[model samples]
Target: MKTYFRLLSFARPIGRYAIPYVIYTLLAVLFGALNLALLAPLLTTLFGQHENAAAIAKPEHFYDVFKMLNYYSMKINAEHGLFRTLQFVCLTIVVSVLIGNIFRYLSERTMENLRIHTLLNLREAVFNNVMDLHLGYFNEERKGNIIAKIAADVQVVQYTVTGTLQVIFKEPLTLLTYLVMLFIISYKLTLASMVIIPIAGFIISRIVSRLKEQAAAAHTSYGTMISYLEEALGGIKIIKAFNATPYIKKRFHEENLHYSGIMRSMTRRQHMASPVSETLGIVMVSGIVLYGGSLVLSNNGSLNAAAFIAYIALFSQIMRPAKAISTSFSNIHSGLAAGERVLALIDQQSQIKDAPDAKPVHQFREAIRFEQVGFAYNERMVLNHVSLTIPKGKSIALVGPSGAGKSTLMDLIPRFIEPQSGAILIDGQNIGSVTTDSLRALMGIVNQESILFNDTIFNNIAFGKPGATMEEVEAAARIANAHDFILATEQGYQTNIGDKGVKLSGGQRQRICIARAVLNNPPIMLLDEATSALDTESEKMVQDALNNLMKNRTSLVIAHRLSTIQNADHIIVLDNGNIVEQGTHVQLLEQDGLYRKLIEMQTFSAN
Candidate 1:
């Protein structure tokens, strides 16, 4: 019950959708009770009681119902006029059925609106939280699990919560109204019937408790399976090349088997609830019939036959609501687990957020400086007491072996990862003092692997400047040497690049990324081995474009091939997160240190 209450909290903000639903559900329940209650008078009339004798007699004592019926039947010629009364009874029953169906329709429509609105908000909030999470969170969490929370788990919450609320409020009211009708017919019989309700409820409570545990386990297993599948698909090419298909298949099978096992347990528990509840209802109904018949026979006219028959009908109606309520509890338990997951994500506070008094910078000028910067991934240091200064409009090249912290240092410029022990000053202002959005707006980055969407070439380039005119987009593409290739295609700038630009060659994709960065025209540019993956011809073409793009911008280049940055204003060599050499390309070679070894290796590899 506590878990269910927690789950309902997710619907609080969207209560407008739910409020109307509650009203309609109540109205529906009322109509359902009215439908059953109408039958009581009809049955009395059909039994040939006098038309004016309070056919649906309100019971004063248990015997008043039976005495009045017996007295009226002796005077009225019921056998002669039975068909006329039967016709009126059937007409009233039809009207009652019509009302029940109409109410049911209204309840269903209301639930639809609530379900759609609640799930929509929930999905949006989860996705927005994912986007705002710190980069470090992604490094630790699986992307597939996050997606599952947004897609699958959210849907589960929608159906479970809305359905549970509907049943809890609507069905109980229905049961209550029917119980009232039963009491009116025979108070003693109604009380006798209720004796079995608690026992059935206790049994259902035990079953649903176990079901909740299995439901939580099932959701976890499903999430794990999705995560594994996503990982396998993302690396399928490597798996195939290495002939590791059997290994991945075995892993997937294991997850699937585990998921299946949990689902089987959950289903078994869920299926038991309805039958056990209904069977108990039957036993109770039989008891009511035997006890009421004994009272009638022993007391000799103590029970009115017509009212007793109506009471039995009302008692039977209880079984469905009882079954529905038990099932709804199981669903509520499952939904609570999913609700907890979504709330956990929404409640996650980003480690990097703007300070209350943070200011936004409109322009950037002067030098960018990193002073005594230190950073770590867990306990392992990636950057140690690093310091560097690059004047405005100068190109600085970072040359290092792999794992030498070149990329890590570049990431700090955009505040993607903050340093633990130092401050980065952009244009003489500490970047920490400015809003992250404002700080990142002053920079552009192009990585070795180009990231493009499945959209038109024009849209991909225009992504950097969302409102850029076609002329501005064309000019930027020309600067990156991509305009000619783009125009050579059938649809030119309008051509779709397919998924992640897989439709383009490696060099072509790299140029598209460069064109995107060029369109931004930021004051600072960070290039992370941007040309290392290209062939000789493509590298030359891209290098020329990069040279043009670097002009008059404060650029930070992470270069693998030393020749690419031979003309840089200042070149810094790093080894094990420490700067080992700093000077011009020629000056660094003169020292014959790590820089010279790298140049010698690249020169040998090129030959």
Candidate 2:
């Protein structure tokens, strides 16, 4: 319940829609009640004894008694001499129903607008927070879970918040208006009719509580299934090569079964809500009929038969709202559980945030320096008291075995993960004192995998700088050696890259990524094994392009092939998160330390 209240805050920004929906709903309910209340006079005019004619002629008297009945006596009485009056009353009822439905439609339209507006803002908020979170958070959490929260969880919240207002507010207003009309008819009978309401409400409350538990389980099962499917598809090649199709199928089936079981339980409980409430209402109606019939018989001289029958019709009208309320409560409870999940995601605070006094950095000069830097993932230290400096317009290379944290070191340069203890300075200004966006904007990164979106070749190349002219895109592509191939394709630069650029070869995709990086023209470049995925011929071309690209920029290279970084101004050899050796290529080899041993190992392997 508390979670639901928190979720409602998202709707606060869109209260313009909610306020009008409330007003429209109330108007709809008023008309609906008017339709029911107008029935009494028509009943008296048609079915009352001739001696009651004078009373029937006075619509006020007939209206008072008509509001007292619990059934459809008005239609029954319309069968006699008062046929014209019945026609008029039926026309009014039709008009009221039409107006009620109109307001109902407007209310729904408003709610839908609110849902879409809130959902868009929610997705934006979640994606923005993801960009701001520390890299360590990703190490401990699955990408699939975060995807589910933004996509599925956010959708759940939209549906629940919209449905909650409709069911809890609109339906209850409709029910309450009818109850007041019932009270005006005969206070005694209206009080009697409500005897079963508390019991029905209690039963509905119990069912809804259980439904919420099942709903929460069902939502969790959905997220788990999505995670499993994501993992299976992401590793489809491995699964197929190992003939693990049956294993994956079994796992999927188990998850589906669990999801189905919870949904079935919740559905059964929800289905019973309306029927159980209706049955109790029927029992209450039976009591009204017997008790009200006794009153008619005992007071036969005073009571008009048509008026008594009219009161019975009015009593039955009250049950519709009661039943609706019962069903709505069940839905609201289920929705609240989903709402809680969405609110939790929206409320998540990033561990890394810009400093209160942060400012945008516009230029780079001097050098980037790491002063007594240390970093950890969870409790395991990855970088310990590490300090380094790279002057502007120089090239530095990091070479190490896998898990030696070469990539982690480069990640720190970009502030992807903040150092646990120490500071990184860009041009003597602490990196933490500048906005992350401005900091990253001044650097370009190209990773080994060549990440590319499923878009046109032109769009992918222009992604680094949106709105780049076709000529500018072509120029960048030419520098990266991708222009000739792009023009040779059937669609030229307009050709689609397919999912993750799978339609392009490893070399083509890498060159396209290079083009994107070139288009940015940042002063700082971080190359994470950029040539590792290319063939020998492609590697030569890309390395030449990179050599030209790195000429005057401050470059940080994470190298896989030892020979590639021999010309680097400085080479840092790392092992177990600590720098073991640092110097020029020949100088490090002469030191006869870790760098010398690594060079000898590579030379031996090649021979």
Number of the predicted model whose lDDT against the real structure is largest? 1
Give the per-residue Cα lDDT of candidate 1 at 374.
96
lDDT of 2 at 587: 95
Candidate 1 weakest lDDT stretch, 10 residues = 68-77
- Please write out the lDDT profile of model 1 over residues 1-607, one tens digit for every residue: 6655655665656567667767766777766765665555566665644654334444456534334433344334244465655565567568767877776787788777767777777788889988998888888888877887888889899899877777877788888877776776678998888888899899989987876677778777788888888988878899999999999999889989988998888888888998999899889989999998887677566576666776777788878888899999877778888877877888887888888898998887789899999988899888899999989999999988877888889888888888999899987888889999988888888997889999999999999688999999999999999999999987999999998898898888988998899897888899988888889998988898899889889899988776679999999888788888899988998999988898888731110
- Best of the candidates, TM-score: 1
| TM-scores vs. true structure, each candidate | 0.92, 0.91
Q: Where does candidate 1 stray beyond 4 Å?
A: 1-15, 49-84, 298-302, 603-607
Off by over 4 Å in 2: 13-15, 50-83, 301-304, 603-607
Residue pairs with colliding backbones in model 1 are: none
User: What are the candidates' C-alpha RMSDs?
Assistant: 3.6, 3.7
